[model samples]
Target: MSEPHVHASHPDIARRPRRAEGQLRKVIEMTEAGRNCLDIAQQLQAVESAVAGAKRTPVQDHLDHCLEHAVGAMSRDQRQSIDAFKAITKYL
Candidate 1:
């Protein structure tokens, strides 16, 4: 496969960041309002988690679509990218 096939995950993955964006904005507002520390921390954590989840979807989609293409074409660079991507997920 020369080009990646569009996997079914794209639409949902696209939406995930939008939700996180709103949540992140709320975090800023909450900070400005001098919200309780615990509440702020909780919301910040939620935002971080949401953002992480949103990122995971696209990375996973890339792995599903692009990696398959790369493997089929025997591209070492893409394989190396897959390895690098997987290594970073330990932090995620």
Candidate 2:
């Protein structure tokens, strides 16, 4: 037997566009504060739970979009720089 593919095609998806604006502001603030993936993931938990109860808001969606852009803009050297920064900052 094959496993079922669960997708989020619920009615709330349509309402997401409406909540996107405010959520986007919060995402920007978090990102600007230099929160890393783990921090973002933790915050995502709260956002996801809220989304489950209501609709898919723009905070996570905006974070996803911004992260995609930031990562795409990095070159190999830039990524290495980030790794080095992480290594040094790890001790602090």
Candidate 3:
């Protein structure tokens, strides 16, 4: 039997730049419009699904850079607030 191909094992993955500025800009715009994290995640899913076979560099970039930085800078209360928001959004 032959094995199925998997893009995750591809060699070019590291070279991909996750979270291009354009994608980040879209995310910011959505947030500014009062869209919740779930909404943002849905949009990200659409983008990922639509661009199948391509590396999701932009999304990863946002997580690595913007989200990481924001979380790192937050106080305990702010972190709790974000965590609570995420819990509600994810379960809803």
Between candidates 2 and 3, which one is better according to lDDT?
A: 3
Candidate 2: lDDT of 50? 49
Poorest lDDT segment (10 consecutive residues) of candidate 1: 69-78
**Global lDDT scores for all candidate models:** 0.77, 0.54, 0.56
Badly placed stretches (over 4 Å) of model 2 are 1-24, 55-92
Better of 1 and 2 by lDDT: 1
Clashing pairs in model 2, backbone N/Cα/C closer than 3 A: none
lDDT of 2 by residue, 1-92 (tens): 99863334434555544355455556677889987877766666655554554533333343345445666767787778655654454333
For each candidate in turn, the TM-score is 0.64, 0.30, 0.28
> Candidates sorted by lDDT, descending order?
1, 3, 2
Indicate the residue-level lDDT of 58 in model 1: 75
Clashes of each: 0, 0, 4
Predicted structure with the largest lDDT when compared to the true one? 1
Q: Which stretches of candidate 3 lie over 4 Å from their true place?
A: 1-26, 53-92
Best-performing candidate as measured by TM-score: 1
Model 2 vs. true fold: TM: 0.30
Q: TM-score-based ranking, best first? A: 1, 2, 3
Pitting candidate 2 against candidate 3, the one with the higher TM-score is 2
Residue 57 error, candidate 1, Å: 1.3
